[model samples]
Target: MGKISYYTEEGLNRLKAELTDLKTKGRAEIARQIAEARDKGDLSENAEYDAAKDAQGLHELKISKLEEVLANARVLDESTIDASQVSVLSKVKIKNKKNGAEVSYTLVSEEEADLKAGRISVGSPIGKGLLGKRVGDVAEIKVPAGVMEFEVVEIAR
Candidate 1:
């Protein structure tokens, strides 16, 4: 079974659109490739046919994985998200305890994480440490480099 993942309405819609495209255009393109390879002749010695078959298997695997993700997805209502403490969908402002550098991030699911956009996955090391923290609370997060401390400045939705 796939793990359940929560997404904002926009994120969910994006995922659905991708899945639809993969099922339609993606499948059609792969079928065309396979047909072209088959027409190239001698199956026993055809490298193109072998490569196309392998690609078809990979394509099907991708479709199955996407279907599982969609089946386990749940859309979260942003307005209903609690901003009192850090949690999924909460936009949190934090200050680095060591250098006093401040940054803000929106906690989202793995699929919706875009670091450039200030969105972080709830499963990330920093996000995990920030979870359930109230304003003025400090969180010590362990990353690949080392442990770092951050102070919660604010939380919003």
Candidate 2:
């Protein structure tokens, strides 16, 4: 069984839209490329045909992987989540113990993690360390730089 990953409704919808595009427009483009390459010359000597076939294989593989992800994906209900501790979908504010730098991050699924948007994957090192931590709790996270301590300052939806 595939491991279940939780997502927000918007995230799930985005994935569905991408999958639809891949099955429709993406497949159509690949088919067009293959047909165009086939018209050029004999199959044995056609590098373009071979390349198109390879691209089609890769595209199909991507679609299959995405389908699997969607099959295992579940939409998380924000209303049921407890705001007292850090967990997936929780927006948490943490302060670096050494530098006193504060940053807010929303813990999300690996697929939905966007550092630029302040969304961190729950599977990440810092996210793992912060899991289940309440306000005022210190999380000792082992990052590439070394162990860094972050104090949980606040937790919200």
Separate clash counts for every candidate: 0, 0
What TM-score quantifies how close candidate 2 is to the native fold?
0.99
Model 1 lDDT tens row, 105-151: 99999999999999999999999999999999999999998999999
Residue 6 CA error for candidate 2 (Å)?
0.2
lDDT of all predictions, in order shown? 0.94, 0.97
Name the lDDT value of residue 99 in candidate 1: 98
RMSD of 2: 0.5
lDDT of 2: 0.97
- Residues 1-157, model 2: lDDT tens digits: 7899999999999999999999999999999999999999899999999999999999999999999999999999998988899989999999999999999999999999999999999999998999999999999999999999999999999
Instruction: Superpose all Cα atoms of candidate 1 onto the true structure and report the RMSD in Å to 1 decimal.
Output: 0.8
Over 4 Å off, model 2: none
